[model samples]
Target chain A: MSAPGSALIEARGVSVRLDGRGILTGIDLDVRAGEILALVGPNGAGKSTLLSVLSGDASPNEGEVTLLGRPIGDYRALELARLRSVLTQANAVSFPFRVIEIVQMGRNPWMRGSTVDDDREAVIRAVEAADVEHLLGRRFTSLSGGEQARVSLARVLAQSTDIVFLDEPTAALDLRHQEEVMRVARGLAAQGRAVVVVVHDLSLAGAYADRIALLDSGRLDALGTPAEVMTAERVSRVYGLEVRIHRLGASGRPVVLPLRD
Target chain B: MSPRIRAVGLTLLLAGVVVGGIVLSAITGQLAITPTEVAGSLLRAVGLDTVWAPTDPIVESTLWFVRFPRILMGLLVGAALAVAGAVMQAIFGNPLAEPGVVGVSSGAALGAATAIVLGASVLGGAGIAVFAFLGALLATLLVYVVSRAGGRTEVVTLLLTGIAINAFAQAGIAFVLFVADTASREQIVFWQLGSIAGSLWSQVAIVAAVGVAGVIAAILLAQRLDLLALGERNARHLGVNVERLRLVSIVLVALLTGVAVAFTGIIAFVGLVVPHIIRMIIGPAHRGLIIASAVGGGALLVLADLLTRTMVAGAELPIGMLTSLIGGPFFFYLLWRQRRRSGGWA
Candidate 1:
């Protein structure tokens, strides 16, 4: 068990170049346990790439990512799978597998371990958490885009890993489901898990994430609480749009709105 | 019916059909033996003395030396091809993928043809089998490498790659036929058409060994294959070694299809049609799908072989031709359905 507020995964000066173009450069970040870390950026800003590098899906050209005090590359696929789960942007299933079957697949990494007995309980809890119990019998391919996103989240949740990476998980979701997904992420963090999410919607990230990391041109532009990073000047300058920030409700969550001249 | 019940019912139904087909195939030829006589002879061969065992030498010899080996060959080859098809579909993540459609059978056929033409007899009786395995391996690797762009295999690209490989393999076979002697030319042509007319026990033993082993290996891979259907990256995230699984499955497909083709020649579409239909009946949970496919494929070929022998008066039609006649239209139907759904040749 990792101590709360300690880094579950730490990246040191990570740099990635693909096709001779830099996707990420000299980035340092830590995904600490018991918090939601949102990677917020404009399109083509390498939010997903940074998430990929941190999740072990992509290796950096320079620097290192360490998970659980060991280099990410040192872990085998199954070992990494047991330690972390990733929900990619696209949720396409080639065959007509049912939703329940897809969720059950999340237990694969645990199958070879003593935690095998927890599979059914884990799947049931995940299905409830993502509110996908109703869609269990339906074919994955037959679901709507929003429904697919939730079901994919259920699969990620069912993996029961300490660290989770969700890349634009709410992109195809409705407003209600988007909030539900963030609440689920919060619930995971409440249970001492580390969550790293990429969000295109700045306001949603401000409302839910404990700390926000703003990326601009593959560099870490800002890293702090929503109020500290969601300033009008930085948001407008990075996104190339004049944006107004408003503190809302008792929690004073920053809400970013594009300024209309 | 519940899925579990349906799966169980389908398994029982396929087993019955395979057993019935085997018994029917054994007794339906020119031999005037009864089912009881076939049973008794089988029993007696296993050291049971039964009164119903045929006293006539001709009937006994025909049953053991002729019909039994042919029937066993059909069963083994059918199971092999269908399981190979299931494995191919799993690896490629496309239902349209098949050994015959993807040119694996033709490649093996070309290898066997070359072996026949070059008089590879000095390498022992298994020379054609070895060459066929090599040819199928090369074709499988070639198709896999060329058809995949990025990580996924697009249906159009896979089918087009199949077409290109099929054309190349057919030309190679033609060249082998052209250079062969008059006697070897007849053998090559006959082998290309595919049949089990003169199957021997030794050949049956080889196909049986390879086919059974391949099916077991495929069943072991069933769970990973189900994960693979979620796409390559997703499968990798779930702990499946996608590249290693693809490699092992490709070799398994080549070994099974190669040995089957080495004996029965290019028997078309058993792989495609059988596994697809089994998947439809049982859903795509590969363990059940593959087992049912092996049984269903064996039953289908046994019955088809029976039809080939008796469809015309004393004329044996090529079993491969009969299968293509049916499977070709089924493939078209599948393509049409996929087109209507995806709204293009995606």
Candidate 2:
């Protein structure tokens, strides 16, 4: 049980370097429960790297992360896993596993050493929640990319963790599917689960995210509410392109658009 | 039938086939014995006073001293190789990742060659087997160490390291053969081809001990293996210590493969083929896969050995050769089918 408004995951002075190239320089951020925080950046801006660091998939070279008021390093792998679930950019499985089977994998941590009494129920709920019930019996690889993306979401959702990290969950999706993904993120947040998403679609982030953290060249450019952060100047400065901000109808959230050169 | 019941039924059927194969193998030599005779002799040997008459001297001697040991060794080695293959496939998350893919067979071959050429009688009659096991274990360790970095094993590094080590081991074997006398060279070549012809009760007991332990350990790892199919990051998120699991699986595979090759020579393809076929028939769940593979492997090898014994008049083909001959085409067909579905090799 996490206290609302307190950071579920906090990164302080986190830095990462891979293969002697700096991927993420010193950075600080906090992901509080009951909110959806979208990380938006240009390619190679270290958004995914930062997400990995915050999720404890990869440790930072220099700084430490704290999760639920405890140092991330102090928590065992299984303990961290129980609190957070990550949906990575690619959910490629080489085998011909069924969609249901893939979603069932999300319950592995809980099912370990105990009878899988509730796993079926959890999987069914997640499948329906993510709108992947139709894809249940099909082989995972046989599905279209958008369907696979939704199924992968179902897997992460089935994990039922308090903190969820999704990297481009709607990348392959059509417009409607993309909105459906954002709606699911909103649903998770409404359920009091913290959702962290990395998205290239600025409009989607603006529409769905409670807060948007804009990153540029491995640095945090802005961190505030979507309207506060998606200003025309900051958008152009970070993306190196002149842009305009338009308010979507009744939402008060600003949509970012690039202007013609 | 439900999937669960079908799996159980398949497992029982496989076990029965293995038992039948073993019994048939035990009685299939030049001195033929009926199944009733095998049961009666087996019962009487266990101190049960059977109603049947006493067996002839030559038949008794052949059955107890020679055939039974060979049959037992075949069963143990077959089960060990297939189970090891299944574990390797699970850990690597690839159906093609067999024990031999990591240089264990080549390393064991080099060890056997060294033992034969140098006449290293350190362990007396068991010297070759001991050296072979050590060689296989060392090769597996070398591959693990070379591929591992910062507590994670890169898949590409593992595959490349295995290729490099295997090539190096082949050079070592070539050198050993070059230096050995004619008789030792012949012995080395024959050993490389693999045979259960000279299997002794002592060898059977040793292989059985290692094989049984490895299979049990592999079976216990089935649940974790299922999680691993989701890929490494996903498996880690599911509470599996991916690095530790890989290490344990590697060591167990080495033990199973080393012991199997030590006693029976480089019996190729049993590990790779048996598991693949079982997975096709019973699905890829490791719980059923492990048990089915063990039984299926034993049955396949026992039948292969029987074929080797009876295929030609007063001659025998290498058991390893037979497996490879059958398995190579089946492997190609699997790849072809996968290509047809996915439109390309993954």
Candidate 3:
């Protein structure tokens, strides 16, 4: 249902400079409605920096960022908060809060009334969608790391925003939860929302993302369909690792199978 | 115990303590009024009549003048300190955090001391309150800014900055004490020892008002505190205006700390000790911890003050001494308990 050529977000020549050093420079990117973009990069590739700018959590040193056709800075806090949500790689949570209670925090952007039924409904749906409904009543911090990740996923699912920014959202998860997160992000894209994820896992990104944007040394190395962008040559060049790209049957999606040296 | 059962048990015990503490505090004193007499006196004072007749004028005077204000101030101070303490802990993200432990109380005390010694008589009634508030605000802002100099402000950095500021401020106060005249010395002494002595009705009224406002604000912000418990980055991702939340909460806690320190002087430990106790009862959820600690802290302080007054005859010890006596051991006990549980403090 995505409108043809309707850009959900547009960043033009966006550059980020922090602490007397340039973290990202000469970056231009766009994502259309209903597309899942994987920001793939090695460490220190400015994937987090670019995600930070797009989610309105950080600003570009030069040029500009626009979300949903509006300048990032011009959007009111509530407006910006309502339109997008971010899930960073690491979270330091303390003490135990009921899973449902933790998930209800996603409603902070829209809650005007005290009645939390709608919020709870959203949480329930998110938890069910994330396959963590069994852990809804459990304490969040008490859960395993993988379980906490799923609960946090339920939280953003409850956020139910048009654009979701995930900065290495599955970095702490095991293999199964990593797949679950990719599946969820892809599902969100299928529902006509834009999902941008920063990932180190070449295989996961290749499997789920409609397009892969490879970042190297804070610059865009490649940005195109998974088939076009992900090749053994590019992977080895960017990540300094021997990697083979297996073109999976039918979908024509490139499955990255790294050839260890 | 499971979290749910522990929560329920703590809630009941805290309520019992508060109710029992308030009733006992209000009803008993050196004058030895019966429960009926206390009830009747309160009823008539508030324009509600029961079967009991009016007590003697002197006893009535005692009720209206001494006991009532004392109890109210205790409740205000305890509640204010606890709220401020909880906010500090949340902002600093350390369970050991306290309003005074971070220099907020002493800073307010220094401002109040300066106001009195300099006779900033123009401020008159509001003089001490304003000075205390300013001092607290300055200290809080200083700690926050100093800790942020390197583009990062974490819990450990903020706590250490607080320690450094507190040490420097105390050293300055000592210099002031060394150079002061007798009258100023006595006043500073009283302030340092922290007495609720000479708590006039108006003063009590101010403390109550500010304390209530502070506690209410904290309670309303309980959700943000909970989100914040997840840390700054996590909080921002959840749509919390991380900087704004930090700024507002720090300012609010400073205001409450200043007001509490202004009138009550440098009462210690209630803020730090009480909330930790409450968290042990209610678990770490700030939503429940803030409100429960407010009520529980208020009750504890009022009761402690009542003990301070009646603990000895013909002489009133500084309330600071009393709370320190209690808090110092409680602090050590927490250390010991933590040692036993985890083998060492983090």
Candidate 4:
């Protein structure tokens, strides 16, 4: 494993085009261990697309992604799965599998190796972490949207991979669960896993992410600490709306809000 | 009850039913034979002489040649169709997916009809089976390729594709029928009705080999099939080679369905009803569901074949007709329940 601050995955000059339209273009980013990197952008700015490319889910039309010093394309699917876990936006399961069963599915990649021993403990930890212990016996299909999202998050956590990608993990959550999800992401990063999150809530990203990459029109408009990348002027220009930034808490995390007359 | 205990209990119950059906079928044929005679004859064939063994040569011959082959054929074909249905449901991630409903059976029937119409004796006795396998494979591939859109198979699209393929295969069968002579046409029609009457040991052996191999392969793939219920993209994320898994499963379904169809014509709804009922009892895990479906299917068809033999006082009914007669209503009930739950199919 790489050191805590070392790059776990690197993308160089990545571009993605779908149906003859550019979804991402000339993007270069590094996902390092021990930090939560939030990809924040307005609608259609390709935040999720970039996350997909970085997680080896989608191949970029141009450039390459390297994971653990090897070309991402060179690794077989199971190999990549052992190294990364992805929680997609949609968590719909066709069958009426129980919640515990779904979470145990996260251990599937490790089933063939000695690491299989970690399956049970990892599932228990993830269940507790995602606060889905109470929902274990319930059918996944019977859960509400927010409950489904948390159960899905527990499954991802149970995978116990070195790198984690969460796409809009808080979209369906209420305020408390939203904060809880971010805290889980923070906990993942603290455990020395690289967490890449595609988020719409700028304040939550700023509060939890060690670094923020602001995307505009499929390009990386700014990349730095929250205070630097989340300035009001750039945020306003990119989002086409006036916004104010307030620094709150002892850590001085930036809170962004739209300036409505 | 826990799923584990439930699976074991169901399996034992199905086994008892299968063994009972086999004995009942052996004894109640045109020539009456007692259960003791059936058991004693079976043991004597294995070189243990008993007074209970049938003394009449005709009784012994009837049990050995006629009843055993038909009973074994029912077991093999039933298990094959049910396993194929379970695999198809897992691969498509939809409970409604089944070999007969999705046109694989009709496609095999069309191919078998063609082989008979063309006088395929030059290709050896296995010509019809070979042709049926090819037809089933082609139909399965066609349905899979045509029905999928944006990396997922919608229920409506899948059913519509089945209808189109079934229509095309039926037309092909009709043309072959129009060209055939009287004897061949009768043979084709009888086969289409789906029966194991006068099944030979050689035919039973062939179905046993293919059915057993296909069911074992399906069991080995059970875990990966479970992952597929998460949808194609998520399954891939979990390290499943979704495309390869789907391709292999489709081929496996074709092989099982084709072999069963070649012998029995087109036994409908055993695939659909058996697996669905098993899943409802055992939950959606493919390992338990596939094994239970196989056992349950074998028992179902054995009992159904027994009913066909005994239902008419002096005649036999087509096993396929019996299955469809019951299956049609069960399928309608499932559709109605699904509609009520989902608030109508969009």
Ranked by DockQ, top first: 4, 1, 2, 3
lDDT of the candidates, in the order given = 0.90, 0.83, 0.79, 0.90
What is the CA-based DockQ of model 2? 0.58
Clashing pairs in 3: none
CAPRI verdict (incorrect, acceptable, medium, high) for model 3? medium
Candidate 1, residues B115-176: lDDT per residue as tens digits?
A: 88888844654888888988999999999999986566888999999999999999999888
DockQ of each: 0.84, 0.58, 0.51, 0.85
Give stretches of model 4 more than 4 Å off: A115-117, B121-125
Q: Classify candidate 2 by CAPRI docking class.
A: medium
Which lDDT value does model 2 have at B130?
75
Candidate 2 residues lying further than 4 Å off, grouped into runs, are A112-115, A249-251, B116-130, B141-165, B180-186, B335-346
Give the worst 10-residue stretch by lDDT in candidate 3 chain A.
Answer: A88-97
Candidate 3 ranges with C-alpha deviation above 4 Å: A1-5, A113-117, B1-16, B48-51, B121-124, B147-159, B332-346
User: What is the Cα-based lDDT of residue B214 in candidate 4?
Assistant: 97
Q: Which ten residues in a row have the lowest lDDT in candidate 1 chain A?
A: A108-117
Candidate 1 lDDT over A1-261, as tens digits, reads 577899999999999999999989899999999999999988988999999899998899999999878999888888888889999998888788889999999998888764655999999999999999999998898999989989989998999999999999899988898999999999999999999999989999999999999999999999999989999999999999999999999888999999886
lDDT tens per residue, model 2, A1-261: 566667999899988888998888888999998889999999999999999989988889988899977888777778887899999886777466778878988887687654566787778889987899888888887898889889989999888899999999989999888998899899889888899999999999999999999989888889999989999988998899999999978868898888875
lDDT of 4 by residue, A1-261 (tens): 568989999999999999999999999999999999999999999998999899998899999999988999888889988999999998888788889889999988989874555788999999998999999999898999999999999999988899999999999999998999999999989889999999999999999999999999999999998988989999999999999999998888999999987
TM-score of each: 0.98, 0.93, 0.92, 0.98
Cα displacement (Å) at residue A228, model 2: 0.8
Candidate number of the best DockQ: 4
